[model samples]
Target: MIEVPSRVSVRDLAKVFQDGEARVEAFAQITLEARPGEFLCLVGPSGCGKTTLLRCLAGIETPSAGAIEHRLEPGAPGAEQAMVFQQHGLFPWLTVEANLHFVLRESPVPRQEHDAIVQRLLERVGLARFRRFYPYQLSGGMNQRVALVRAFCVQPQVLLMDEPFVFLDYQNRIVLQDLLLELWQEQRQTILFVTHNINEAIALGDRVLVMPGTAGPFAREISCPFGRPRDVVQLRTNPDYQRIVVEVTQLLRQEQEHSLREGRIG
Candidate 1:
């Protein structure tokens, strides 16, 4: 049986990078939590430490201060996490099927089931036909499809995504957004997605956390009023969606002004 989703908690989180008396504080004095199966989106201007925070949650980077906890449902199996980056970090030498297998080498999934897991997820994403194809042989959008399936194949407890579709054309972005939501609806993993697109954040998230312009505590936490399963294309027509867009935009505008006053951004 699949382990239930985990709840994430962070207390007084901070990250600082130092090099020979040169000190850079990525973010500091932060506190947040993600409820089980909740889709959380992080939004901010560039260099607000969004990615740094995500790395901490994924256990890739250690925080300079504070605590992070991934508390799974009682009696559930152990937790697993996966990440999808803006770049499709697939090996040119490996075909799509092989790339998925490579990730499972370090994953908890059984070796005997690896082939089936890869095949099922690829088929779910309509990428089964391209399984033997190399990443270089695929379009940027198709490679991203492979990347999405690869991340989901492990059925991670926490899925960290960093602007995975930012570079795609509008049409493909929308299509992939639908695909991602469809997969998440079934997989129900706790997601922490980082994106600059306000619409994307609101459309995909249950709650959106807006960060300050510079490295500091988070700015605002606004709950998305939309009900799921959401349709991204039709979401714009909803009055509340438009209202939330304006609301988040206003909050971001305020954050930019604050950054300007603090000399954090020019």
Candidate 2:
């Protein structure tokens, strides 16, 4: 198989925040590449700047230093990137279908084409029956599914997710993960996901990037060589999957210890 170049590249990325009279360094010299059609997860302790990194990639926030270059397809209008947050950023006043249609309408597509796209996405996310239902009528997981479909409908080249499944219950999270994988396979969009959950990251990511702490330049990168169309049930019994999870868990533990040591010193 021939190797393709990275779709997105970040070199020497750094970010700083002003806290009172002092300058607080969040991360420095962070370098990473997101290859085409790869699911990359950024995992670390809370406040480890994972969300900030995701924001930078989404163009929601600018990096204090370094460069991020998105190599878009020829003739494409800018680089299409979308972000899904932990909160379901849905409009309460709009119905499920209406919420999706609202986003689609913003695009340059004709009204007829936009309607078709919104209908298909609603059905795809298993919200066809809830199309007329408002956000308050849907459960937390269902609302999140709407959010995911809303983002996917735009056909973004890159999807930036920050703990999108964090609010769901265990069973809901599992179901949503499977649905997300299905959508990802169907769309083949490059994804950069941030999560504190190790198992979730291991299950979803083709490569996991682990950041050490809030002020981290990511410390480690682990590749998941397991074949996909990955099944949650089968993964529990797969030795390779188990081994990688163990390795990642160990790495996280080490980071925790390092964080504690730093805390004591400070």
Please give each candidate's TM-score: 0.93, 0.93
Which candidate's lDDT is highest? 1
Q: Candidate 2's error at 166, in angstroms?
A: 0.7
Off by over 4 Å in 1: 1-6, 73-79
Candidate 2 deviant stretches above 4 angstroms: 1-3, 76-79, 108-110, 214-216, 264-266
Question: How many residue pairs clash in all the candidates, one count each?
Answer: 0, 1
Quick one: how many clashes does candidate 2 have? 1
What lDDT score belongs to each candidate, Candidate 1 first? 0.88, 0.84
lDDT, model 2, position 244: 87
Candidate 2 accuracy as TM-score: 0.93
C-alpha positional error of residue 30 in candidate 2 after TM-score superposition, expressed in Å: 0.9
TM-score of 1: 0.93
